[model samples]
Target: MDESSVRKMSPRRAAELLSKTPGEELSLQAWEGLREVCVSGMQDERLSADERIGWAAAGALVVDRMRDHSECADRRVAMASEARLRAYVITRFGREDDSSLRDLSLLIRRVVDAVGAESWVVADSADGWQRMTRHEMLELRRIKNLVTPFKSILPLLSPTDPLRDKIKEWVDIIPLLP
Candidate 1:
């Protein structure tokens, strides 16, 4: 499909198309189309809650695909996708009473691991560290607020569940945030 058509497509239809596309490997065009559909869906305020969730799921799927196919040579794009997915989750669900928090935590961990210290560096200057610290502080506040209610139940997760570790790690690190 052309860019214009993809731009005008409904989130449901875009998700349907993405679902049909083989996951073994995605062509550049296919990936771009899916990305556009997801961004459009997220930005379009007329969509119902269900539609927005579907679009967010689509964005999550893209993040998962990027993680699985790490050699896709689009690290920056994947980072942006993950950031958008995280923001969508935070905006849609302010608490961690559901599985969406698990997804968001995992995405944040993945981005942190993939980008390393670079993710914390927003610019190249002595003052950049201050800006980065402010951003980290805000993220820490959001994460703490979202995960505190679920803290008691997090340990009950199976040892094999990666989110258990990720959440614990975040909880442990939040205390040291400046």
Candidate 2:
């Protein structure tokens, strides 16, 4: 959606748009609707974008995890899920501004949707990743940066191409590997 459309949205409306069609373009209209409501409840101006995106990302992550665990099917669940998704984005990126948060959330959601798989299915960090502190994210980023390129590992992992098949697969939590 364009800037004008974005300017007119409510958060609830934005959430519905995402749920109805998960991979829509970067609809600035939708982000504004949600951010308008969410940003006001926050504190630091510097963190506002981070908070918004963090809420959305964390909420989305939690919601995706709850798909089979929770039975709620109402709009309420959607609202809560959006909140969680925003939280995750904040936690990951350390920002909490309206525009930054919503932009990151939409971008992440779109990327996940485009791949036609849950985000976890694509790049789930190890079990400890969810609990990572700000220091940890920075450390991990640095560690990743310092690593030298490898011509190959013993055996390069065959990346799972999600689009080649239509069957939805579930992660077997017990196995520690999906």
Candidate 3:
């Protein structure tokens, strides 16, 4: 889809466009469009959390598909995409029906894998982890202590859940980050 076309896209349309469009074919404008759509979708209370996550996952896949491609070489943008994906997984996870739990698990895996050596800035609050903007979270870290959001998600997963192991592995790796 073109930039203007994507800008006008609804969550469902954006998801469908992202799913079918190859990463290499996506212009930077398209990337921005996906980001815009994902952000707006998150704020749209009319949509269920599961639906928001579905749209977020679709946007995240662009980065995953272009991981080694030059189009995704912009680290700042990639990190933002990763943060958006992580925010959805951390905040909306387990809030939906059990049928979608598996989907969330897969999205979590993808988000974690996409994170690799990147440092994620997130804030925890009574309103939940998704309430803060990335800039706000970054500012708070400059002025106060913060915790890795992944560690808090462990208690939400069952011990027998396969996703628990992946999350545990991710949590174990966090402290090792500089």
Q: Note the Cα lDDT for every prediction shown.
A: 0.54, 0.36, 0.54
**lDDT for model 1:** 0.54
Per-residue alpha-carbon lDDT of model 2 for 4-74, expressed as tens digits? 44334444443454454432333433433444444332333555554444334333533443332334333
Segments in model 3 whose C-alpha atoms lie over 4 Å from true places: 1-4, 64-69, 74-87, 93-149, 159-166
**lDDT digits (tens) for residues 10-34 of candidate 3:** 6567667777777677666566666
lDDT of 1 by residue, 33-147 (tens): 6666676676567888667767776666655566456355645456655655665555554435355623555555555554443312422222323456665655444433433
Q: Which one wins on TM-score?
A: 3
- What ordering of candidates by TM-score runs from best to worst? 3, 1, 2
Total residue pair clashes for candidate 1: 0
Clashing pairs in 1: none
Give the runs in model 2 whose Cα sits over 4 Å from its true position. Answer: 24-139, 142-178
The CA lDDT at 84 in model 3 is 46
Candidate 2 weakest lDDT stretch, 10 residues: 146-155
